[model samples]
Target: MRTDRELTPAELDAFGAELDALRERTLADLGAADARYIRRVRAAVRLCCTAGRVLLMFGWFPPTWLLGTLLLGLGKILENMELGHNVMHGQYDWMNDPELNGQRYEWDIVGPADFWRHTHNHLHHTYTNVIGRDDDIGYGLLRLFPEQRWKPFYRRQVLWATLQALLFQYAVAVQHVKLDKYFKGRISKDEVRPLQRQMNGKIVRQWAKDYLFFPLLALLIGANALAVLTGNLVANLLRNLWTFAVIFCGHFTEKAAVFPAEVLENESRGHWYLRQLRGSSNLEGGPLFHILTGNLSHQIEHHLYPDIPARRYAEMAREVRQIAARYGQEYNTGRMSRQIATVFRRIWVYRKPQAV
Candidate 1:
């Protein structure tokens, strides 16, 4: 068992080989079971959305509207997290179904799938928690890690963080546009122009689908358009809040590590695996919770083998924990509430300590 923080050259090569073998074995195990799981999830999402919208059309009744909105929210959350995130990760790419195609599927979110693929799959996955390299650390909004340095702006983080949670999807949508990069002259206006256009197109379609077209259709059916619209808004808010909570717990828990930029310089693959493991924390949850969070509750496993189908993460998690134990590494994880409390605690640490 290796106890070193940094891997020796031989150890690095050997560790990479071990991980590669694990990945291949896992891939070989993928089959109809994984394919059927995602297909059912996709079907459930569609059914829920269809039923929810139909119920909301009877919006004069409070119970019907509330239940409808809840269903709608659940469907949207599943579409983005379980279906879209996994699909776009190429988790079901082997199925070769065009609609389930990861490379081409567009999610029902404000963020363009293309941008998310680049920012999350390429940037976040590649860099993990390496500060300045992975934008996901604080997401350019709050100061989650002490090493991020203090500024007067962070004093308002309570407000910033709250608003961020409420408007989480939109915040994530704009993240890949590199507004800060352009301002700092790292990127130019021309580079962001095409991205801006793509965002605009997606935003228009999302707005039309959710707010305008649906509400207008409800009006045509003699339903209260206003109530239907309100229900939609409520559902979206709920989805946003839930997503923010789950994602925060996965990455910002107290035990999660944030790497320094210098430490990532010429980082070896073996060292990279260790960095990813330390940098990510997992949420302990049941099967339903895992499905809801797109199996990202097993964040440690996801970071280690992002290309693997997320549904496999739960089972893979057991083996991963064993591997970490053998290698004398901590596999950070805890109950969802505990992780979320730690996330909030991390946010408040800079200003004043909060008991987790």
Candidate 2:
């Protein structure tokens, strides 16, 4: 529980105004270049998907099978991270392209797009790292910070964390259901049924598309059904693992802070900005690495300006660091490997109950 210097009311106001000004500048600058970049990302996604599927149909060849799997995995990552996630954030909605409509755009994951908008765009963003309010805090399954109450179940959090990463999308799919409450009799079964039904429908559709339809189509076309099935499985696994790693590193790093619920009481805009900064970390990477991570490599900036097009984060990060420094705030960031290691260390260190 590292402490941040509490800003005085006037200082908080000034700090917030500066950040709001930066956001305005970035938003005003959004135009042809931003559109071109996202369009290019969409083009790359389509190319990877189409080519990967075509190659997988010839998966009898070892080289082709390997290539196809990697290509398909890349495609899923691009779609999930760069295209789908950003578009669904309404980043490109200003361009007036119906295809990029945040509310209507559906991603390729088993979790429904509508569910994500509520769980992520609304709750997580609004609550960031507030212990009770943010569904993302340990994702209601593990204790990554000492501020969360320890439970016997959290003793094996390292194991739970690993399993969650491997099946990350499914974990995301069930997040909105709040099964913990159901088990404790907080919510009734009837209330849970509709959400469960929606989740189940999404799972069935996703599984059928990847596991059945694609494989069966390959079989009918005289290709190896087994190969197609395995390729899709491996590709999805890759997307899940990568996505889990990137997201976890961004939020659960050693320096990231979780807030007490009381902090929300009459919190000013500057205090909110400060909380977002302290609770998020950034990963340092090359341009391609940033793109693949949806520029969440600049997670600090993303938290600060979640609605701003992520492609603009890299540039915004430089100014943000300077602003943070002037405000005497620490800007947390590190290499992906370093940040990932920190998250793992947090998981292990907080696995046991904290001493009084």
Question: Considering every candidate listed, which one attains the maximal lDDT?
Answer: 2
- Model 2 stretches astray by more than 4 angstroms: 1-3
Query: Which residue pairs clash within candidate 1?
Result: none
In terms of lDDT, model 1 sits at 0.86
Candidate 1's C-alpha runs over 4 A off are 1-14, 351-356
- Give the alpha carbon lDDT tens digit for every residue of 1-356 in model 2: 45566779999899999999999999999999999999999999999988888899996698999899999999999999999999998989999999999999999999989899999999998899999999899998888888899999988998999999999999999998878889999999998889999999999999999999999999899999999999999999999999999999988998899899999999999989999999999999899999999988898898899888999999999999998888888889989889899899888988899721
- Candidate 1, residues 1-356, lDDT tens digits: the string is 12335556787667667777788899999998988899899999999889899999997598999999999999999998999998998888888899988889999989999999999989999989988899998888778887776667777788888998898888888899989788889999999999999998998998898899989999898888988898888888998999999888877898888888887778888888888888888988789999999888989888899889898888888888877776667888889988899888878876442322
TM-score of 2: 0.98
TM-score of every candidate relative to the true structure: 0.94, 0.98
Q: Model 1: what TM-score?
A: 0.94
Model 2: lDDT of residue 111: 92
lDDT of 1 at 274: 83
Count of steric clashes across candidates, in order: 0, 0
